[model samples]
Target: MTALERIAEWVTSNPPVTAARRAAATDAFVDTLACMVAGASDVSTLGAIAVASHADPRESAMCVDGAMRAPSSAALINGTAAHALDLDDNFIGAATHASAVLVPALLAAARQAGADGAALLDSYLVGLQVQREIGREIAAKHYTAGWHATSTIGQIGGAAAVAHLLGLDATRIVAAMSVAVSTASGLKWQFGTPVKPVHAGFAARSSVEAALFAQAGVAGRSDVLEGERGFAALYGAPHADWPTAPIDTSVAHAIEQPGLFPKLYPCCGSTHLAIDAVLDLLREHSFAAADVAEIVVTVLRPNAANLPYTHPENPTQARFSMQYALISALESGTVSMADFEPATVRERRTHPLLDRISVRTWSEKAERIMLDQGRTPHRVELTLTNGRKLDRQREVARGAVSEPFAPWEKRRKFTSLSGLSDAHYDAALRLAASPNIDAIERLLAAAIRLRNGAGE
Candidate 1:
């Protein structure tokens, strides 16, 4: 059977769900909802909602603001909002912002099908697994070549999840995934722009549409992912090597393994490691931002490429700017959500510390060796005005599996970003045990109003 067929079969077979997987899924949902609330007013999300409001306005699925639109339109608006701040979690296995796409798309499908919270979590795991499986074959090559995996891989995997929620059979599941391939598209070069978040919107909308089409009896080539002139052949290396046998998931699921990476900082993930490294140095030594004469950061080539802005003119570009991120961390000892505000960017842009920062990338050969050895830390070098240099390297960010945020920290982030009452947060945490998705939708709607009223 083709890999896609295997995925469809496994999803339909009702694979076992572990307690750990359920917890992870629940956390992801809460985090994504918080991000959605925090980003609801972003220009990109507003733009998507404006377009969606005019498209169908069928009032079929719930949006962040409590209004209803067609399922696909809601997915587009919600997904855009979820990812607009670049604070959404990451799945290293798939090299995608898994939750940003999956949560919005699945929420829409779940409401349409009246699926319960358990079913929604199950569908999320299924979709993330599909992305990990496909990514094993092509993510590195695809991402390094400038494709946005969040949109490309996300559309395909999210379609399978939506299909599952819609109760499509394996045959129809294959059709949904195949149709998704045609819509899978996003470029990494669009990073640092409003278009970047819209990519998630596009993927979420396409996934919902693909699944709906399949449910309507539309079909496509079953081998569209691996056939001649297909997804892999067209999107990856011509001779990209795929596994001879499917990896075993019976004993361990992807979420319990490589896991989803939650972000502690609200900036492009590529900048996190460097920021962590700088923060480490500050903890060990006593020096204000003004005392720093020079700050140099060394990272992988792809990460450096992702951070092209040395002097960002706006908040969007600041998210992708290593110089801006490091300076913010150095000066304030933390990179808060407020750090990315327009006035903050404008004020910080002229700081002399911005000029003190410079970035360098490891050579391809060096990076390859580090990858093979299984450790590729981002390095930060700090030169003080007194001519003393402090060096630090961080292999993992604070919010990664190896170094997780405390429970209080997680709660703090959710409340701070979502601006919702603790009662809403409690409701979100109990989602796995809830009978339906009604509470979640209501909480998200309240979060939107509260966050907006606070002028965030």
Candidate 2:
């Protein structure tokens, strides 16, 4: 069978995921919801809502404005909101923002189909696994080729999730996957722009539409992902390594290996390791931001390429600027969402630090080591005016699988973003464990109300 067929079978097999994996999926869902709430007020999100509303007058629940929109429109708006601040969870291997795409698509399909929570979780897990596998097959070549995996790979994954939620058979799921491949599109060049989050929005909405169309008997080539002139050959390297066999999720799921990296700061994941390394140094010594004469950060070549901005003039650019992220963390002892605001990025105090900070590219050998270890490697050096220097290298950023966030930290993030009462917070956690998605929908609706300042 073709690779696409094998993937379809795997997705439809309903492989058993461990309770730990399920819990991790739940955490990812909750974290993405928090990010959605935090970014609800962003202009990019508002613009997306406006666009989606115009295209489709039908209404569903939008997490941002508490306005009902069409199911696909809701997916577009919610997905855009989830990624507006670049704070969504990322899968390192795929180099894709998995939850940002999957959650919006799956939530839209589930609500439309009246799917329960367990089904939602299952479909999400399956979609994440598919995305990782596809990402692994394409390797870094696809991303390095300037294709944004969050939209390209994520479209197929979103289709799988929606197909699973709708209980499509293997053949129909294959059709959905095939149809999704044609809809996949995004460019890395759009990074640092509102178009970046719009990529996630397009991926989510298009994938849902693809699945729904397929389910309605729209025919598509089942081998669209692996045939000649297919997804890999067209979007990735012509000679890229495609998976030869079907993956067994029952043996090991993607959520349990090379897992999701939840962001503690609202910036690009590429800058996270450097921020952590700098914060660690600050904790070890007694020196103010002014004490440092120079800060040098060395990161993998891919990371260096991702962070092209040294002196950012806006929040969008600041999120991708290694210099900005590192210096802000040092100056404030923490890089909160507020640090990425225009006022903070343009503050006079940050200009001096931005001048002192330099980001360098790591050696090719270090990049190889990072690929082998599945880590985001970064080396930090702070040179004090007194001529003393402190240096440290971090292989993994905090909040990665190796160093997961504590329950309290997750709760704090949720409460801070949603501004909901403790009762609502507890209800969200309960929804995670419950089999009822109606409860989940209600919880999200309440969050939307709070975000829009309607229920206060």
Q: List clash counts for every candidate, in order.
A: 0, 5
Highest lDDT among the candidates is held by which one?
A: 1
Clash pairs, model 1 backbone: none
Per-residue lDDT tens digits for candidate 2, residues 127-151, read 9988887888784878878888999
Across residues 1-456, which tens digit of lDDT does each residue of candidate 1 receive?
A: 876787888889888898778988999999999998888889999999889876464567888766788999999999999999999998878889999999999988886788998889989999999889888778877887888999999989999999999999999999999999999999989999999999999999988999999999998888887788988889874566655465467897878767888998999998999898888888889788888999888998778888989999999999999999999898789999889878889898788977778889888888878866756589998999999999988887888878878889888889988887778888898888888988887887676666657422
Q: Between which residue pairs do clashes occur in model 2?
A: 58-70, 59-68, 59-69, 60-68, 60-69
User: TM-score per candidate, in order?
Assistant: 0.96, 0.95
Q: What is the lDDT of candidate 2?
A: 0.81
Every candidate's CA RMSD? 1.9, 1.9
Q: All models: lDDT?
A: 0.87, 0.81
Instruction: Point out where model 1 deviates above 4 Å.
Output: 55-58, 451-456
Which 10 consecutive positions of candidate 1 have the poorest summed lDDT?
447-456
